[model samples]
Target: MTDTPWLTVVRGTAPLLLSIPHTGTELADLESRLSSPWTARCDTDWWIEKLYDFASGLGATVVRTGISRTVIDLNRDPSGASLYPGQTTTGLCPTETFDGDDLYRHEEDKPDAAEIEERRRTYFDPYHAALQAEIDRLRATHDRIVLYDCHSIRSVLPRLFEGTLPVFNLGTNDGRSTDPALQEKVRGILADTGVSYVVNGRFKGGWITRRYGQPDKGVHALQMELACRGYMREPGDKASPENWPSEYEAAFATPIREKLLTILQSAIAWANG
Candidate 1:
């Protein structure tokens, strides 16, 4: 077994923790159980680690999960509760993909309750352990710590949303996760940039944000869900296994990148205040 979890930790000077839960691609033992290898990788947060790579330069700490969400969604509530109740998102150990397709080809192949728990013990637990450890470590040096949960999905997944999502989807759980002033600053930056955005619309922070965000207690949280189209050219029809990265052009992705840096910088300022 690999001694270390497939994760990359980048320490920074700012009191912010950036988490990339969906950017992982490792399937490992879970590969053989997938309904289709292609579907297993369908919901990945493509190029997110790269998109946010500039954070370290800005002195923002980064913690990324390296195992695929197919194993056990790191951002989800381990109790199997929905992040968006009555909505169409998957679970901690998803048995189905976003399109309502089976994740395992046969019922017998699907992981049982015991098996799911095993995956959690082996995968989910360790990832969060690392995340929390960092949060605790950073809290000692700063008065406040902002947990920025980063993620991205296809621009339009019929199973998840009605119309095409905006380029930037900022979620602070209806502004309860952080100070209103901080929320406004981030929103204002996006607004000034002329980028399409919505606040607390489809996604409002996930398990990490809701669980840890306590402004009065000196911890704040935010989630940024980027639309895949903003960074990569997704095929109109079906995603080919060969062209998986999908031709990400630097020109289109560069603007979003700049905005993200501004947001992170703004978040750090909020933490210091």
Candidate 2:
């Protein structure tokens, strides 16, 4: 059990760090203020942590949070800067889902600046603190460390992207967040899988990748964004409110999971090299 009430961490000896920041769906005290449980949590990176459950066994230190993104997005820039300047993206405390659905019951119910700061202290700060601590711990022994941030989104969100996203979206801030060879290794793995994949595409990593990634300093970070449909049954063309987040079907997820297992293993191999 962890004494850090805000975040969850699993220690490992390897130089790989697995960060699952957006999978949390809990709203805590803010649940009453939000529109409803379902809408507020609709944008969550559903079951992303579970998708990477095998990382722990591979000796990758895992850091995650239980506070919903509606409360505070752990991967967003806490300073309220947009990760994608001109594009539509959620804030540190998102008031809307990816499809422009309101999260608060009323306009005023949305978190004010002071409340946002408070939530940052309560949720955001602890998560990054734990992540940094894990990186330091892993980097102490290994010459180089890899921080792999895990994420997933609905297959189609017109508000977010033009059409359905590819199966795997790898982001490295255009190769600045990690070694170019490491990115090549991952891209090679995805190529072998023979599925639709892209690197530094729509998602070119986020705050965690940009902030903690110092490849020149022996710390590398990468973000792997998976389209939910790749591993789950994504309703229909438009994943509406009622039929949105499909349940976690282990059998349905096996194929992509195998690819991901190899990706993670390859990351560790690159770090050790």
Candidate 3:
């Protein structure tokens, strides 16, 4: 078995923690149970972690998991509760892809309640525990901290949203996960960039943001869901198995990186203000 750590952590003094939960692509011992490796990992946030490599230089703590979401979605609630109550959303351990593609070769290989619980104990709990530990560690020195959950998806997912998603989708759980002033600062930066963005559209912060965000107490959490086109090339139509997940190019992502840097910096300033 590979001894590589399940997650990587870079401790920083800044009052910000970048919670990147979906960029992982590892399948571990569950490879054989999956239908196709590509299909199983197709929904990953893809290089979202790399997109914010500058975060450490800014002294922002970063926590990233290497285990694939197919193993167990870390952002999901451990109780298998839906982040989106009425709308369509994947579960803690999704059985299918966003496009309704089955993740397993044999339906019988699908994880049952027992296996789901095992995966939860092995993966989900530790991730959140790591996050909380960092939060507690940072909170000791700073009066306030920001837990920024970074993510990305294809611009167009017919099954997920309507026509197309904006370049930046900031979710603060309807302003409950973060301070209103901080959200305004972020929105101002997005507006100045002239890029499309929405405050609380489809995604309104996941379990981490909702559970960790204690705006009144000091820890403010926010989820930044970026559309893939902003950083990498995406298929004009719906993504297929053939033409999807373009590599992360420095030149292509340079502009988006600049804006993201500005956003993070502004949030830090606001938090420390």
Best by lDDT: 3
- The C-alpha RMSD of each candidate to the native structure, in angstroms, is 2.2, 1.2, 2.0
Compared with the true structure, what per-residue lDDT tens digits does model 2 show for residues 62-179? 9988888888898999999999999989899888888898889898898899999999898888888888888888888999999999999987888988987999999999999998
Off by over 4 Å in 2: 1-6
The residue pairs that clash in candidate 3, if any, are none
Candidate 1 clashes: the total is: 0
Each prediction's Cα lDDT score? 0.83, 0.89, 0.90
| Candidate 2 clash pair list | none
Model 1 ranges with Cα > 4 A deviation: 1-5, 238-244
Candidates in descending lDDT order: 3, 2, 1
Q: Number of clashing residue pairs in every model?
A: 0, 0, 0
- Order the candidate numbers by TM-score, best to worst: 2, 3, 1
Better of 2 and 3 by lDDT: 3
- Give a tens-digit lDDT track for model 3, residues 73-188: 98888888788988888998999899888999898999999999988888888888889989999999999999999999888888888888999999999999988988899988
lDDT of 2: 0.89
Model 3, CA-based lDDT: 0.90
- Give per-model TM-scores: 0.94, 0.97, 0.97
